[model samples]
Target: MGLKSWFSKLFAKRVVQKMYDDAAMAVQHQEQILSYLVDKGVKTEFGRDHHFHAIKSHTDFTQKIPVRDYEGLRNYFDRVVKGETSVLWPGQPVYLSKTSGTTSGAKYIPITKESIPEHISAARNALLSYINNTGNAAFVDGKMIFLQGSPVLDNSKAIPTGRLSGIVAHHVPGYLQKNRMPSFEVNCIEDWETKVDAIVEETLKEDMRLISGIPAWVQMYFEKLIEKTGKKTVAEIFPNFSLLVYGGVNFEPYAARFRELIGKEMPTVELFPASEGFFAFQDRQDDTGLLLNTNAGMYYEFVPQEELDKPHPKTLSLSEVELNVNYALVISSNAGLWRYNIGDLVKFTSLSPFKIRVTGRIKHYTSAFGEHVIAEEVEGALSETLKKDVAAVTEFTLAPQITPESGLPYHEWFIEFNREPKDWNVFIENLDTALQNKNPYYRDLIEGKVLSPLKITLVEKDGFQEFMKKRGKLGGQNKIPRLANDRKIADELKAWSVKTIASSNF
Candidate 1:
C-alpha cells in the first residue's frame, strides 16, 4: 500500500476501535446527548417556549415537547430565517439545508456548527469502518465520486442555503479533495443531464474505486458511461472500482440491475442520513442492519408505528425499544430540532447495540382498502421474487387502483424493467404471494376478495426517468415513492406506460 492507503488503514483502526467502545455504551451516550442538548436548549427561545428547563427525564421530555413535523416547527424556523439570533439554537446556523417539502413548499433545516460534524464524520467513518473490517484501504488511494446536487449556495437567506448534498460538498475534507472526482466546475452545472454528461467526461479515465450516490441517479450515470464508451459493464471502464457507497433509498430493488451494470457484486456501505441528522451507518458487512450513531450529538425516540396517528403517542427511548417492531423515528439534535418526527419508520434489527433497518416512511404507504402495505414490504416482496427470477428492474412504484374499469380493484405496480422477466405470469404470482406473506392485512384483503392480486404495468424503458424529469425532479436526492395511498402518481405514470402490455396484463 502507498503512504495514503497505509495512513488510512492506521487511522481506520483507531476510529473503528472507538466506535466499538461507543456502541457498547449506547444508552449512556444517548442519555448524555439528551442532557447536553437540553442544557444548550435552555438558552434558546424555543427552549423557553417548550419549557426545556423543566425536562429532567425522557418522560418529562415527552410531556413537555410534542412530536412535530416541519409545519409544527415552522414558526421558530421562520424566525431563524429572518435573522433572529437564538430563535432555535444558541446562535445562527452555519447553513440551512433546503429540501422539498410536502405541505410546505420548501423546508430549510438548520445545520449548526456543533451538528455539522455528525453529518461529515458519520459518512467518513462508514468508509473507514469498511476498511478496518475488510483490511482493504487501497480504495482510499484512488478517485472517489459522489453523484450529488450542485454545490452552489443561495446567500439570499439569512444564512447560506443549498441542498443537503450541496451543503455537504463544501465540507469534503481537504485530504480527500485530490481523490474526489468530477471537478467543481462540472458539478456546478445547473441541469442534471448536462452535469452528468460533464461528469462522464471527467471521470472516464480516472482510477475510480469509490462511487457514492442515491441508486437511481447513479444508475443513470452508469447507463451514460456504458452508452458513451460502448462498454459492457462499469467494472470494465474502471477496473479499480470496488466499493459502492449509497444512501437516501433502499438498494434492494436496484440491486439486480446494479449487479448487471457493474458486471459483479462488490462491497457496499449503506447510510441512514437526512436533513434532520445523520442517524446510522452500516458497520458490519455480514449484517444488514445499520448501527445507530448513539454517541453523535443527537437523542433518539421511537413512537410505536400503530400509535403514530393518535393525539398523544407513546414515545420510547433507545433503551426501551424492542426487536423487529416498526417505530416512527423522532429526534432532538444539536441543530435545535426538538422531538421532531423525521417521518421515517425503522425497525430494530438488533438491540444490544441498537442496529436498525429503515422499513418505510410514515406517510409513504398504500392503505386505500384498509391493507396497510409499507415500503419495506413491497421492496422485500420484489427483492424476494427477483432472487428467484431472471430479471432486472430499473424502477417501480405501487399505488392502489381503486377504480379499474372492470375487474376487482387492486394494487397497481408501475415497473420499468431493465430486462423483462422470462415468465411474466410466474413473476407476478411470486411477487403477489411474497407481498401477501409480508403483510397479513393485504393477505386478508386478497383472500376475502375485497381486493384482487396486484397487477403489473410494464413501464417503457426510461419511463420513470421521463416522469421525474417532466416534474422537474430528475436528479439529486429526489426519488420515486415506493408506495402511495392514492392514484396521483399512478395516474401520472400512464403517459409513460407501454401501451402494448397495458391491455394484455390486465
Candidate 2:
C-alpha cells in the first residue's frame, strides 16, 4: 500500500479499536458514569435540590428529577449563558447552542466543557467504524466536504450562540481540518446561498472523498456542483467520493435522488446528534439502527411516546427498554441537562449493542382529526410508493386543510418531483393507501367522511427551496417539517407556488 493509504488504515484501525473498547465498557460501567455525573454536579442548585449526592439509583434519579423540556430548564440555562459558574454543570458552558422552539420562539442549550469531546469523538468513531466495516480507508487520503451550518456565532451573549454544527466546527482537530473542504472563513459566512457558492468554487477541483451534511442541503450542494461544472453526476466532479455521512433528517425521502446525483451507490453513515448531545450513530455496516453512546458521559431514559403528554409518564432506564417500542428520549448529559426531554421519538431495533432508529419528533407530527400521522409513517409511505412507481421526489411536506368551507377536511401534500410518475393519479392512490394501511386512525378517517382522500399538489420547480430560502432556513441543519397539525405551512406553500402544477382532489 502507498504511505498515505497505510497511514489512513492505521488511523482507522486505532479509531475503531477505541470505539469498540468504549462501547463494550459503556453499559457495563453505566452506573459509575451516573454516579460520577451526580457527584460532579452535586454542588449546583439543581443537583442539590434533586438530591444528586444522595441519589442511589436510576429510580431515585427519575423520581427526583421530573421530566423537563427546554422551557422547564430555560431559567437555569439562561443563568449559565450569563456567565454563572456551576449553575448547571461544574462550570459555565463552553458554548450555547441555539435550536428551534415550539411556542417559545428559540431555545438555548448549554454545551459544557466535558461534553465537547463526546461530540467530537462520537463523530470521529462513527466515520472510523464505517471505514473499518467497509475497509475503505482510502477516503481518508482525500478531502471531505462537510456542508454544515454556518460556523459563525451570535456573540451578543456572554457565551456565543449558534447551531450545533457551528459549535462542533470550532472544535475540529487540526489534522482533519487540513482534509476538510470549505475554509473556516467560508464556513463562517452566515448566508446559506453565498456560503454554498463559495464551497462549490473551492472544492470543485479538490479530490473529495466523502460528503457529510443533512441530505436536503447536501443534495442542493451536489445539484449546484453539477450545474457549475457541467458534470452529469457528483462522482464526476469528485471522482474519488465514496462515502456520505449525514444526519439531522431522515434520508428515505431523498435517498433515490441522492443516489441518482452520485450516479453510483455510496456507503452512508447515519448519526443521531442533537443540540442536547450526540446520542447514537450507525456503528456497523450491516446494521440499519444506530448504536447508543452508552459511555459518553450521558445518561439515558425512555418514556413511551404516547405517554409523553401525560403529567407523570413512566420512564424506563436502559435495561428496562424493549425492542420496537416507540419512546420519547430523555437524557441527562454532561451538558448539564437533567432528565431533559429532547422531543425526539425513537424505537430500539436491537438490544445487545443497543441500536435504535429515530421514529419522529414530538412536535413534528400531524394529529389533526386524530389521524396521528408521524414522520416515519409518511416517509415510509412515500419511499415505498415512489420505489414501486419508479419515480423520484425532490422535496415534500404535508399539513392538514381542516377549515375548508364546503368539502370534507383533508391532509394536503406539497411536493417537487425529480422524475414524475407515469400515472400521477395511481401514485397518489398508492400513497394514500399505504398511509391508511400504516395508520389505522387514518384509515378510520378515510373510511368515514371525516377526511377526504389525500390531496397531492405538485408544486412548481424549486418550490420547496424557495420556501426554505424565504424562511431563512436553507442550510444543512434546517429541515422542512414533514407533517403539521395546522395549515400555516400549506397556506404559505400555496401562496409561494401561486398555482399547483397538478392536484389530486378525491
Best by lDDT: 1
lDDT of 1 at 106: 89
* True-vs-predicted CA distance for residue 370, candidate 2, Å: 1.2
- Tell me the whole-model lDDT of each prediction, alpha carbons only: 0.92, 0.85
Q: Which candidate is the best by TM-score?
A: 1
In model 1, what are the clashing residue pairs, if there are any? none
- Lowest summed lDDT over 10 consecutive residues: which window, candidate 1? 497-506
Runs in model 1 deviating more than 4 A are 500-506
Estimate the lDDT of model 1: 0.92
Please provide, for model 2 over 48-71, each residue's C-alpha lDDT reduced to its tens digit, 9 standing for 90 to 100: 767787788777777788999988
> What TM-score number comes out for model 1?
0.98
